[model samples]
Target: MENKIKLLYMLQTLDLKLMDLEEEKGDLPGIVQNLNDQINELQAQIDELRKQINEHTSTREQSNLDAETLNQRVESLKKQLYEVRNNKEYDAITKEIAEAEENIMAKMQNAEEHDDKQKELSANVDELKQKYESLQSELQDNQKDLQEVSKVHEDEELQLKHERDKIARQLPQETLVSYDRIRSAKYGKAVVPITRGACGGCYKTVPPQLNLLLRKNDEILHCENCGRILIAEEIAAEVNKVA
Candidate 1:
């Protein structure tokens, strides 16, 4: 009975260590994925800004061409005004010249506005690219750190798991099943020692008769309140000494 109790304790300790190792590894994958997602999103924004800049540049060029065409039309109308045959023809040429001048002014204004928008879009793209590069560097560093940590813990976790399996194999089938069930239900504590004539798991006082039986270590005992396997304090001390 003493040996069985000690084996359970050892198994529990190994299982707890394995759980801790798993927890350490669990968050790394998600963190890496989130970083990659951020980098991708930033890159997309950069691309969109670049596209907008291209569109604005094309529109600006078209406006400039339109302004040039209207200016040429105004010059031709002025030449025609000098050759007009009468006041009616002179007034018609003047009216045409006025309309062309107005169009030229409107096109030049539109081109200037497009130029300003293009500059703004280009600046935005540059800023987004810089942010993307910084995020990429951060992601690489995180990946390297995660790799180092995994390499360090892999062997230790494997050895602990092997030790836990060996100890479990040495325990009785019924006892092993009960221990696993209770450990799962009780957050990884299946066996507990009596402390101050009370259940160590639940901190409830044990009856005098039950406490006396627990101290004997002749038979497997369980705490009635929490259903955890009970071991005598002396038995726990002896196990620790041997370890």
Candidate 2:
């Protein structure tokens, strides 16, 4: 292999490693965001449950007040019955008393139902609070792990970047520019292999002559269709063996 070709091969290996490291690090932020989202969802559920309990309790309280007032009105009507001036007045009082008694019964039934609903809602809120506490603890633990992973990867990321920069410097400016463009176009995989007369990246067929030229490793070669640098099958097999 020519010296420049060897350098390119070395650069390719380094480039692949750098890509792996960067891709791994990129997912950390998302992991952190997901953890935060889970925590927020749990807290929101707890808050919603508490609000439900509060509304139920308020309804129950209002029902109780109305029932109390209706009872007072029924008592007042019963007292007025003793002072009726005529048959018509007595009949009127009796009707008023019956209506007030019915209103009290209805209010009592509503109060009882409201009490039961409040109890059910309160229990539900308590259960949700317990779950929210557990989720909070879990989120704390996940955040700690995320921080530790970030710290560890920071050093590994710096070393990979340094190595990548060193390899980039060894190539000609024109080659590096071309590599950058291809890396951008090919999703960070600028160098690929030619295997069985096929482009490894795009899986497009290469001519037999081009495949032969790739095997020699005497000059820089690219897949005509994808424009990605192509390594020979022999080199790839050796890499696979070592790996």
Candidate 3:
């Protein structure tokens, strides 16, 4: 192949490397987004648990107030019993006292039930809080890990970009432009090595005469099937050493 094509092959190699590094760096942002989503979900669950605990506490307190009001009503009925004169009046006061006492008992039972529910809800909230703390810690660690990976990737990407720039300086502008166009068209693979009389880019059979000329290294050979510039192994090995 011509020296320009050989250089183009080298340029293609650098393009592939840069493409790989850029792809890895691109994935980092999505990974960070997923981590943040998980953290948000955990936070939302924690908030919901807190709201439940608050509601249960409020219910318990309200039940206790209802029980206290019932207790006062029972005391007032007892006082009425002491002031009554007639037998009928006495019976009426006794019935009122009984009814008031029953109401107080019912209210006390309701209060206890509410208190028990509050205890259960509070325990659940504590457990949820512990889970949230553990998840938060994991999220933070993952975020730190993502940051470290991103920094490392950025450094590597910068190095690869510097290398590509240096190689571009050594290559002609037209050749580099062709290299970029083909690299993008071929999914970051603008060059392929010929092996066993076949185009490695598309596995198509190369004509015997052209194959010989390819071996002579007089001109660049592109695969008819895939349109990628081809490099013979021996020439590639020599050039690789120089590179």
Candidate 4:
């Protein structure tokens, strides 16, 4: 139990050091991540608009081709009108001509509609692309700033994390889980040593009985007020020296 207490303290120390290193970078990481998300959303929108534009272009092309075929059919039907010998035959040729002309008009109208939509989608894509570029530029700047700050603590932070992992592995799974939970709840401070017979985290006075038991380091104990684990000052000092 005493060994477990010491290991937890060492783990907390390494974790705290790692936290400090990350804090030195300020809000650059968050800013860069936000910019990246914005750029990605904009890119997706641009891609969708481009796809719509392509579909519209294909529809317009097909409409134009259909209109051209109808026009040719109308011309052929008109030439057949001159060779018709009976009134019935003449009427049929003229009817075919009229229908083909009507189809040509419809197809041309459809082409015009698709062309207009294509132009609108193209404009939207251009607008989104500009926004994407602006966000991408901002992301690059923030990323560069974050990179510079991270580079300063890169090796030290890695070393601390490696040490933390080792110490954490030495602790029981239940103890480690509780420590992590408390740390997350209490702003990255899971274990604190007693100071002047008081809780180091919340400054609440420790009861004499609990303080005495803490010195034994035989069991995990938490502060009633802040719920952070309490350790003996002597154990903290010893761990600090070797950690």
Candidate 5:
């Protein structure tokens, strides 16, 4: 019974260490993914801004062409005013010139607005490009760090798992199942020592008879409060000596 309890304690310790190592590695993948997500989002924003800038540039160019054509029409109408046959014809040519000039002015104003918008969009794109670059660099760094950590811990993690498996195989199947169930339900603490005449797991006072039985190490004893396997001080000392 004492040897079995010692094996159980050793197994629990190994399992806990393995769990900690796994937790350490688990965060790296999430960190890499989050960095990638941020990079993608920034790239999307940059693309949308670039699209807007291109549209504005095309509109500005079209406006410029329209204004040029209207200006040419106005010039032609002014020439026709000199060749008019009467006051009515001259007045009609003059009116046409004025309307063409007004249209040209509107088109020029629209072109200027588009130019301003294009500048604004260009600035925004530049800012986003910088941000994107920064995020990309950060992503690369995180990936590198993750690789380094994995490389560093790979052997140790494997050895720990190997040891845990070996220890687990030594225990009876039912005992192994019970240990796992209790560890899962109690946050990785299936076996605990009696500390200060109380259950180490739940800090509950142990009955005198139960304490006496635990010290005898004749059989397995469970804490009444937390259902964790309780080991006596002498048994724990023997286990530590073997460890």
Candidate 6:
């Protein structure tokens, strides 16, 4: 039981050290993450706008071609008017010319509408591209800053995490889960040594009987006030000495 208590304390120690190392990096990690998300969103928007522009351009081109074909047909019909032998034939040729001209006008209008849409989409895409570039530059700078901070603590952090993992593996799964839960609730302090006959974590006075039992270090214990795992002064001394 004493060994278990010591191992838990050791794990807590390593966890605290790792937390401090992470704190040294400041908010660079979060900033880098946010920048990446924004970049991706901007990229998606740019790609979609570009797609719309391409579609509009294709539609305009096809409409212009259709209008040209109808104009050629109208010219052919006009020439056929001269060869008409009767009023009926002359009327039929003129009627064909009128229908072709109407179709040509409709195709031209369709082409102009698509052209306007294409221009508007192109402008929106260009603006999004500029914003994407700016965000990319900012992300690079923040990443560089994060890299600098990480380089300084890389080895130390790795060692501490390795030690923590080793100690945690030696503890029972239930015990480790309890410790982690308490640590999260207590703001990263799961284990504390009894100090001055009081709970070190909450500064609450300890009952005399409970104090006597803590000195035995025979079983794991917790402070009644804060619910943090408690370590006797002697156990803490032993662990610290070994550390």
What are the candidates' C-alpha RMSDs? 7.8, 7.4, 8.3, 2.2, 6.8, 3.0
Instruction: Please write out the lDDT profile of model 6 over residues 1-243, one tens digit for every residue.
Output: 437777888888888888999999999999999999999999888888888888999999999999999999998888888888999999988888889899999999999999999998888888888899899999999999999999999999989888888787788999999999999999899999889888889999888888888776557788999998888878888888887
Across 20-101, the per-residue lDDT of candidate 1 in tens digits comes to: 8878877887788999999888888888888889899999999999999988888888888879899999998898888888
Q: In candidate 5, what are the lDDT values of residues 170-203, reduced to their tens digit?
A: 8789998998899899999999988889998999
lDDT per model vs. reference = 0.85, 0.75, 0.75, 0.88, 0.85, 0.88
Better of 1 and 6 by lDDT: 6
Q: Name the TM-score of candidate 1.
A: 0.56
User: Cα miss at 208, model 4 (Å)?
Assistant: 4.1
Model 1 worst lDDT run, 10 consecutive residues? 211-220
Which scores better on TM-score, 5 or 6?
Answer: 6
Question: Where does the lowest 10-residue lDDT sum fall in candidate 6?
Answer: 1-10
Candidate closer to the true structure by TM-score (higher is better), 1 or 6: 6
Q: Which parts of model 1 have CA positions greater than 4 angstroms off?
A: 1-20, 153-243
Compared with the true structure, model 4 gives a TM-score of 0.89
> Taking the tens digit of each residue's C-alpha lDDT, what string does model 4 give over 51-146?
888999999999999999888888888888888899999988888888888889899999999999999988888888888888888888888899
Distance from true location, Cα of 50 in model 5, Å: 0.8
How high a TM-score does candidate 3 get? 0.54
Candidate 5's displacement at residue 105, Å, is: 1.0
How do the predictions measure up, each by TM-score?
0.56, 0.60, 0.54, 0.89, 0.59, 0.82
Which 10 consecutive positions of candidate 4 have the poorest summed lDDT? Answer: 1-10
Q: What's the lDDT for residue 232 in model 5? A: 83
Error of 4 at 39 (Å): 1.4
Candidate 5's displacement at residue 123, Å, is 1.0
Flag the better candidate by lDDT, 1 or 2.
Answer: 1
Clashing residue pairs in candidate 6 are none
